[model samples]
Target: MMTNPTKMERRRALQDSLNDRINFIKSVEEIFNCHMVNFITGNLWDKHIPEPIKEEVAQLGEEKVLELIYHFGSCNSKLEVKMELTAPCPTLSKYLIACRQYYYDMTDPSINDEESIRSEILNDSSTSVSDADDNIKKRNLSSQYLTPAKKRHEVDVMSSFIAKMYEKKLANQGIIGAIVDIGGGKGYLGSALALRYGLRVLGIDVASDVTDAAKSRNDKICRKLSEKCSFYQQKTVFVTPNTDLGNLVKEFQFLWGSVTRVALVGLHTCGNLGASNIELFAATKTTDVPVTILCNVGCCYNLLDEKYLPEGVIDKAHYCLPPLLHGHSVDLPLDETSGFPMSDFLCQRQFWLGRNARNLASQSVERVMSQKKVAVDALFHRAVLQTVLLDYAENCSDTVQKKLLSKLDEMMVVGKGVGRVYKRNASLNLHEYLKTAFEKLDLDIQLPVEEVDKLSERYDCFKSKIKIFYLIRIFLAPVIESIILLDRLLYLLEKGINEAYLVRLFDPLISPRCFALVALK
Candidate 1:
């Protein structure tokens, strides 16, 4: 039987394959820009959609598109949805099927299944000499621990995987060490590692309140372990790539005695922090100790710094990388310190996905399909509210228009709250609800009850167009998300870090931003 490739080998393979297809990335960006640019700009209301795409969608027939959406959207199961994408459409059938398949290909079942979890965890990295013994130990320990309250099953699995990886690193590298949890909110994963694996942990966060909470939580966990396990908290910014992590540890005097290696781990580190951790681990080189392992799961792509992109690509208008990278040459020099494609190569050819597109990328198709009606209703209501705001603005003076539109921005929040309440109580009167919500907003310009009723009545006419637009946006979500994830993966590979691996580490249905970027030296 052919054995699976090691993590480094896999990273190199992915990098080489993707890098060779620089033109393919450009083509993907063009397709998204052509089909999804308008959808990315704002809500799926009538005016937000581009005229050409709107005409094409209209020609495909709204009834057919709506039919296809409801047929695929109301699927009893994910498998059924994948199988049922056979409905014919003039333009959208191919795109709809592609979206469904993308979701299937990305879903990682082993993260949630108990029987396969251990093998999955062990397979994530290159096999060490003590693999068999480590697997057996992890299997025994998996049953002994209780998953913390309100924590997803995927997180439990991730903590166990990271803990096991830490052990493997310790044994293989022969370094007595401590685990540093960057952005360790509430110290849930850190405490678990300390209690279950008996590894000393230093949970770091920017918020003093969160650090204090993590300390209190760790105290309880240490008590339960019946052994004095050190779980320290430091409130400071630690994600900067140039920050001297070795000196920071020295200042805190954490795990000062006989500590020669550190395992840097972050469970769903937000925004640029994940990328920064990767850079920090690669750049930090101390004579006495070193960061041997780095594991990070990142979310919120919209928050990433545009400065991290190749030079001369940082457009002040947009805060996203793709917009800056689009239509540019892919050949740029790599950063010496981090190996990131600073300017040259495929990094120059990077595609632009707007903030809304990035946000949409994190949504789960399975969850959306399961809650199809609710999702549809929510979109329908949002579109209607947008229409109401537009109408209200059209009727008002310049000053009133500005004031009313500012307050109408709150309509999204109100709509979301109302949608949730409406789902539980189907008999809930929406018109009355809207009136109450709008009244509470206390806009200087009066939107009388009758005017609100008129807007609510227009929902029936707008529902079909809104539903079709929503479905199109949903169909393009995965494609846009794939580019964002690949960029990060490529950034690591460009940095010459061969051990970096991008693994689907959570169930997207429960946690949409579930991919973990792991590296070890």
Candidate 2:
């Protein structure tokens, strides 16, 4: 029988695995940049599409490309390559194989293995609570709120895990104290922790409106439980940017009454706020008030400050690491003020991914694949509209062209909002929608019916090319997403915080941005 690895050995193994994956992503940064540049700048319907992509599409033919897209969409995993091809297009088949392999290779094994990580953390040990306590928690959960079922599941799992971590710290450090909820809008999770665990909670947020809402929510909960919990409207930005860490902790201690231990938590803390929480937790250890644990689940990657980027990525144009390393980077030495080289190993190279790419990273592959038909229809609408606008602009005056472009922008926004309606309403005509969009613009000039017909014909001719471009973009999605999640994980690890873990906390189908970065000291 094989011996199980020690905790230290497992940690080293996980780190090594992450480093190897990071290196792999770095190697392919140029290729990803090339693909993104073509997608961003090249016209899909024209000869402006990248030469390599055009050649592959030509080799596969329109029928084959469509077949492959449909086939890939229905399957759960890329490993399901046994589906027989409609046409013997060796070039396209090879390319499809490569795309699947690239996706699986880039994905971190740890993300899908949430159970294993939880097991490792809990050491396969179960904590016993009285029947009364369990019943109270269940009652509070059912009575408490308007959150979706999936969100409730996430909060339940996360809160229980955090409570356990807090108990473990209490046993070790001989300090039992409050849980601090960062960006605690409406105080859902914080209130739950207070009711279920009997732990004092402090919920903080910058938005006064939301903070007010949270206070109202707490009032309702307190009425139900016959107990009060602390919730505050504090500006973390002010605390992080202008104040001294030691002084801030002292201030919190004074207000909260000798808070010697704290468990910092946030659910989907956006952008730099998540990073700020990590910094605050680390800083607390330096002060008399020590933060024993932290559990932060971050979202909105596009909003993260550029300064927090791995040092190597700061200057590069196509800076975003591939999906595998998305939010995490390899360990790099830290600078006290700037948190430079967020990943230690990433200091050797530079890369950049734009806001569009980061937003793309938040998408769920499973959901996208399942909803492929709807997604493709939306893309088709956009592509056809683009062609129509271009043709209309060709014969028009500069003033007319500018007006047409403005109308096109409005139509794009409307299309996104009503995509499902368009899909379901078979009577809704695309040509009619375009005409209505133009009419709504209330331009002085009118587009003739003949012109609309001509534009529709042109779109039909270029439809195949647009579909192929969409497929290629979809294929690259997972790769981009992986890099972002990994980068976030690396940021914590690079700071010498070893207990950090990246977990898929919610169902991706229900919540696309479901990954959570969990840590404890």
- Displacement of residue 371 (Cα, Å) in model 1 is 3.3
Give per-residue CA lDDT, model 2, range 1-521, as digits (tens). Answer: 54545555544554565565456445434333332222222343343344555665677677777777656655544466644673454555555555555455433344323444565556552332111133223334453364777677667766676666666666346775667787888877777777666665777777778778888877776676666554332333334622243344445555456666667888888766776777776552445556767788777764554444545543233322224323322223333443222444444454345434454555555675667553444455545554444555556786886665544433331222122334354544556656554454564445577876775665565556655665655554565655555555555655666666665556566666666677766
Which parts of model 1 have CA positions greater than 4 angstroms off? 1-87, 100-152, 231-235, 250-256, 284-287, 307-347, 405-430, 444-450
lDDT of each residue in 1-521, candidate 1, tens digit only: 54555555555555554443334334333333322212222333454455555665666677655667666555422635433434345335554555555444432221112223234447633442123234424311232334443254554667667777766668555767777888988877776666555666677888888888887766665566565645454555645777655555555453445666777888877766776777777774554667877778777664554334435432122211133223322223323333222222345655344334445665555566666543455555544544554556667687876665444433321211222334454543445445544555554435576776776685566656655665666655655555555556556555666555566666666666766767767
Q: Model 2, poorest ten-residue lDDT window?
A: 127-136
Clash tally for model 1: 10
Report lDDT (CA) for all predictions: 0.54, 0.55
lDDT of 1 at 391: 57
Q: Using alpha carbons, what is the TM-score of model 1?
A: 0.72
Error of 2 at 44 (Å): 2.4
What is candidate 2's local distance difference test score? Answer: 0.55
Per-residue lDDT value at 403 in model 2: 65
Model 2 vs truth, CA RMSD: 8.0
